[model samples]
Target: MQSLMRVVRSASALWPFYLAVVLFSSVVAGLGMAAPFIIREATDTIVDTVSYGTPAPTRTIVFLALALFAAEAASAVFSNVSGYLGDVMVARIRQILSTRYYAKLLALPQRYFDNQITGTIIARLDRSIANVTQFIQSFANSFLPMLLQVAAVLAVTTYYYWPLTILLLLLFPLYTWLTALTSRRWQKLERRKNAEIDAANGRFAEVIGQVKVTKSYVAEVRELDSFGTHYGETVALTRPQSRWWHSMDSVRGTAMTAIFLGIYLILFLRTLHGHLTIGEMVMLLQMVTMTRQPVHMMSWIVDSAQRAVAGSRDYFRVMDETVEPTANRELVAAIETTGAPELTVIQHSPLDAREPVIGFEHVTFEYSPGEPVLRDVTFRAREGEKIALVGESGGGKSTVVNLLLGLYPVEQGRLTVCGRDVADLGVEDLRASTGVVFQDSTLFSGTIRDNIAYGKPDATDEEIIEVAQRANAHDFILKFKDGYDTVIGERGVRLSGGQRQRIAVARAMLKDAPILVLDEATSALDTKAERAVQAGLDELMKNRTTIMIAHRLSTIADVDTIITLRDGRIDEVGSPAELASSGGIYSELLRLTASSSAADRARLKAFGFRVRDDEAKDS
Candidate 1:
């Protein structure tokens, strides 16, 4: 009940529309009450005329018929108008809820997404919003008017005959108590059902996204069986749940039938004994019948309310989560105040050449307790220096990037970007000052031009073309026959791996931030393409503070400093030449690369590695 009320309170902005709906519904209810009395009057008049053996009062009968018709017609018209208002209010509430949900998602930390499935998150939003909206509409159009009608019926029935009113009053409490008994168990089952559905939807999305992997393994039947098992479990739960609900409903139904039967018997006996007029008995019966409709609908309202309560609980669970702090206020204000917000980029004061562009001091971090991904790690990148991080998989290379961008909070030691503590800096400011090219080359389904200029949405065609040329993507883009306008499909699926990587590189280049982080930025490219893009990157790195991760040892040879990681601790940090002779992780990797196959050596040579004649011949 509290959760249901919270759903209503959340839409307080639409209260005026709700007010209108209630007012219109009140008119419909009042008119509905008039019909019973009008029928009773006409019935008594016809009986009197026949008993007296008088001429038929045709005009009087016609007048009463027209009054009845007018009342019914007005009731229908008002009911429709109220329904329309209810629909409008539901739409507005849906918009408000959906916008809030989306905004909350955007403000949540990266770790929240790490443990949640994309499809499950989406399913919860869709289902919760849908149920809440349905309930709101039902309450406005059916529930409110039902209550009003019941109250009017009770008042009218009590005025004419208190016995029938007593029976009607007793029925409500008994019916409600039985429903309450079943609801607790029914709601529990509904929650279980929702969990299963959410999981199934999550898996469905995962399968569709990775259909290629499933097909390669020929595990279609396996996936289908797994998917069906979730729904099957829900069905298993539903059997007993349905039985319990219907069993209680049957009991409530019997109770109602017995009470109404007694009320009818009393009405008939009273009319026969002259304690009541025929007209009075008829009016009371009509009013009691009117109450029956609401009584029958009570069960449906309870069922719907239960579903709504469950959904609202789910909705508020997300709403109650702590959101990350607001983005850079100054930047936001500038954008808000500017006439051309797209053209405005917040500029910070320049740092001295001697100051570190990035600094980490004994930083230790973990995604889970007692399982650190980075342990007491320290590193520094000075302004205008190109630093490279080289390590095996799961050595916290990506975590370092994630922390620097403020995707995850730094928990143990001090980390600073541009001399400002990362914890003190707004995530938007930290990210706005840095450009990143991730390993996956994530791209949206859009034109080549759109993807390239994604980082700088206001980028001109000439600027986009320049970066594309630097990334060695211009020639391939033109060959698509649409130049830059060709749609690349989702995540650049239509493009080759190398082509996608180049576009990603161009995006980062277009961002033109002071600091650049590249996580295997050129890993997908061929030897020739890598060399060309590497040259372009080298030129771009001249006056920028660049940090990169490279598995290919040859690629980092030209960097000013190399930070080698082994088991999350910095194994060595020195210039490339110094590390080559340090006999550490970097030196070991160099030896292994030097002794690799001919094709590997040739690839290394393309990145300006010195391949010895003996080592080349051995390969």
Candidate 2:
């Protein structure tokens, strides 16, 4: 009930449409009642004329027939108009609900998405919004009119005979009680079915997205079996649920038949004894028959209401999640009063060069309780310094970058970006101060120009071209048939790895942020592609405070400082040359890389790392 009321409140802005529908439906109901009365009066008049041998009142009979036709016509017209209004209301309500849900999704923190499947989240939104909208449309068009009809029928019948009214009224409570008995169990089954459907849809989406992997592994049969199992469970659940619902329906049907039989007997006996006229008996019978529809509709309404309640519950669960914290209101107001834009352009602040551009002081973080990924990790990068983090795959290199970007909060200590503590800085401000190039070079399905200008929407054509040139992507881009206008497929699948990486580089260059983060930017490329992309990276890193995470030690040979991590704790922090001889994690990794293969040795030698022949022989 609370969920239903919440949905009502969510749509309260469109109350005028609701009011119009009610008024129109009331007229329809009133017109529907008029037909029974006209028929009864006409029948009585005809009977009187025949019994007394009077002249047939032909004009009166014709007028009564026309009146009945007019009433039916008006009722049909009003019903259609109300239905149209209900459709319009439903469309407007859907717009409102969908907009709110999307906005909430945007405001939620990244952690909320980390544990959720992309397809499952989309499924939830689709199912919940669809059910809610369906219920609103049903209520406005079907349930409301039916309710008005039932009320009018009962009121008119009561005016003619109180005993019949009592019998008609008694049928409702008994019918409702039986439906209620089945409702709880039916809803339970519905919820289970919904879960199975959501899971199946989620997996289906995942499978489609990773079809290449499935095909490569020849696991299509396995995937099909899994998908089928979910739907099969839903079918299994429906068997018993359908039986329970129909059983209750049969009982309700039997009870309704018995009560109507009693009501019919009473009407017939009264008319026979001369207590009621034939016309009155016919009128009462028609009115009672009119209620059959609304009474039957009660079951459908209950079922729809249960689905709506479940949908709203799911929707509210997402709505109630805590949104990411925002900058202080007072601070925002102060900035607004000064007429400065909410998001300042990324440029160096007026802080002294001595202050760190990025700092993590005694920070600790964990994705789960009692298992820290970064512990007491402290580091800093001063203005115009290029710092590199080197470690094994799970040694918290990416977590450091994540913390600096405010993707996750620092739990034990402070993290500062641009000399302001991250806790006090707005997340948007912190992220806007840096440009990131990840390992995958994530790109959307759009034209090359769109991807390049994604970071700075207002960038001009010349600016985009300049960044592309700087990133060494201009020559290859022009090789395409459409140049910059060429539409790249999803994730830039149409582009080669080198082409995508260079495009990503150009995107970051166009942003022109003061700070840059390169997370294994060239780690996945072949040697030739790595050299090409590394050239772009070198150019992009110029004059910017850069933080790099590199598994390949040679990539950081020229960096001003190298910080090595061992088991989430900083093991060494020094210049590349210093770390090379520090005999710590960084040196060990260098020795390992140097002796991996002749190709690795050649690559490291080209990057100016010393590789003795003895180390190669030792391997």
Superposed by TM-score, candidate 2 places the C-alpha of residue 244 at a distance from the truth, in angstroms, of 0.8
Give each model's clash number: 0, 0
**lDDT by residue for model 2 over 1-619, one digit each (tens)?**
7998887677677788879999998988889889889999998888889889889999999999999999999999999999999999888877766666666676677789898888888898899888888988888887788778779888987887788889999889999899889999998999999999889999999999879899999999999999999999999999999999989999999999999998999999999998877788888889899888878887787777888899989898987787778633333332223121234444332333235788899998998899999999998888889999877667898899888777778889888887888788777677778899998999989999999999887889999999999999999999999999999999898999999999999999998877899988987887789889999999999988999987565677789999888789998999978987789877766766656676766655443334334534543
Query: Model 1 Cα displacement at 225 (Å)?
Result: 1.0
lDDT of candidate 1 over 1-619, digit per residue (tens): 8987776677676778979998999999999988888888888888888888888888888998999999999999999999999998888888777766776677777888999999899989999999888988998988888788889988877887887789999989999999989998999999999999999999998898878899999999999999999999999999998999889989999999999999999999989998877777887888888888888888888888888888899988987776666444543332222121223454543333336789999999999999999999998888888999877677788889988888889999999888888787777767877888776888999899999988677789999999898877888888998889999998899987778878887887887778888878776666766676676677566678999988565567679999988778898999998988899877766765656677765545443334444533443
RMSD of 1: 4.8
By summed lDDT, the worst window of 10 consecutive residues in model 2 runs over 332-341
TM-score of 2: 0.90
Estimate the overall C-alpha local distance difference test score of candidate 2: 0.84
User: What does each candidate score in C-alpha RMSD?
Assistant: 4.8, 5.1
**Local distance difference test scores for all models:** 0.82, 0.84
